[model samples]
Target: MKTEQLINALVADIGPRRSFLRSFVYATASGVAFDAVVFFAAIGPRPDIAAAAETWRFLFKFVVTLALAVPATTLAYRLAAPAMWRRCRFEVLMVPLCLLLAATAFELDLVPPSLWMVRLVGSNSVNCMTLIPVLALAPLTCFLILLRSGASCDPGLTGAVAGLAAGAIAATFYALNCFDDSPLFVITWYPIAMSTTAAGGYYGGRRFLTW
Candidate 1:
C-alpha cells in the first residue's frame, strides 16, 4: 500500500482510545470490595482493634501497602499505553521501600540482634504468603481483563505492575486481620508474596494480554 494510503488507514482504525485510568479504577474497586467481603467472611479484623489502631507499627503497615498500591496503579495505567514507558517515573515507587527500610533499621537498632530473625519470620509468614496471593487472584484477573482493553507495548511489565497493584490491594485487606505489624515482617514476607503475584501476572500477560 502507498504510505499515504497506509497512514489514512491507520488513522481510520484509530477509534476511541480506552481510558486506562477509568478501567483501573473500576477493576481496583471491584477487587477491593471482593477482598473486603472475603476478609470479613473468613477472618475478621484483629480482635484487639483498639489496641492495634493505637500503635504506630500497625498504622505503618497501611502506609507501606498503600505506598506500593498507589504508585503501582499509576504506573500500570501508564504502561497500558504503547509509548508511556518513557513517561513513567519509577522513583515514586521507591518511596515505600525507603520508608520500610528506615523503619526496619530503627527496629533493628531498638531490638536485640537475635530477635531480628523472630521479627522477620513473624507468626503469620505462611498465612501471609498464602492469603496475599489468594486475595490477589480476583484483583489480578480483573486488572488483566481491564488491561486487555488498552495497547500495552510491554505486556509483561504492564502485567507485573498490575500484579503489584493487586498484591498491594490484597495486602491492604489482609492487614486488617493480620496481627503481625513489624517492619521486618512487612519488608520481607510482603515483597515475596507480592512478587509471586507479579510473576503470575507477567506470565498471564504473556499468554493472555497479547493484542
Candidate 2:
C-alpha cells in the first residue's frame, strides 16, 4: 500500500485524540522522570548550585534549554499524526536559536577575546557532550515508540523532532550538573550532542518507521 493510504488508515483506527494526547503526556513524563532518576543517582546537581543560580550565565542555561524543550516537544507531538505533521511549524525552533545567538553575542562583547576560546571550550566539554545523549536515551526511546503508534508521513523528520525534544529534555537536566555556563560553551557543544541524538533518531526512523 501507498504511504498516504497507510497513514489514513492508521489515523482512522488510531482511536480518540484524547487517547493520543494522554499517552503523549504520560510517555514524556515517564521518560523525563526516568532521566531525572538517572541524573540524581549518577550525577546530582552541582555543589554550587545555589551560588550559581544567582549568575545570569547559569540561569540562562535553563532558559535556553527549556525554551528549546517546550517547542520541540510540541512539534514532536504534533508530528506524530500524519494529518497534523504538515501543519506543525518548525520555525518555532528559531526562538531558541536566536536566544542562543544573542547570548553568545553578548558573551563575546562582554568577555575578552582571549577568553573566547576558553569559554567556548569549557572545562566540561567532553562530559557535556557525553552525558546529554546518554541522558536523552530513555526520552528518545519513549518518543520513538509514541511516534510509531501514530502514523507520520515523514517518519524521519518526526523522529528527528522527537530526538530534539528528548535532547532538550536531557540537556535541561544536565544543565544543573554542568559547570560550563557560558553561552559560548552551550552554543558550541550542546548542538553537537543533540545533533548526535537526532542522527540516531533519523536512522531509527528510517529503519523502523517504514511500513
Which candidate number has the best lDDT? 2
- Please give, for residues 21-104, the per-residue lDDT of candidate 1 as tens digits: 666788888988998899889878888988999999999999999999999988888888876778898799899999999999
Candidate 1 structure, TM-score to reference: 0.89
Q: Model 2 over residues 1-211: C-alpha lDDT tens digits?
A: 9999999988877666779989999999989999989999999999999999999999999999999999999998898787776678889898988999999999999999999999999899899889999999999999888777887788788888888889999999999999999999999999999999888888777766665
- Cα error, candidate 2, residue 13 (Å): 8.6
Q: What is the C-alpha lDDT of each candidate?
A: 0.88, 0.90
Worst 10 residues of 2 by lDDT: 202-211
115: Cα error in model 2, Å: 0.8
Q: Candidates' TM-scores?
A: 0.89, 0.92
Counted clashes in each candidate structure: 0, 0
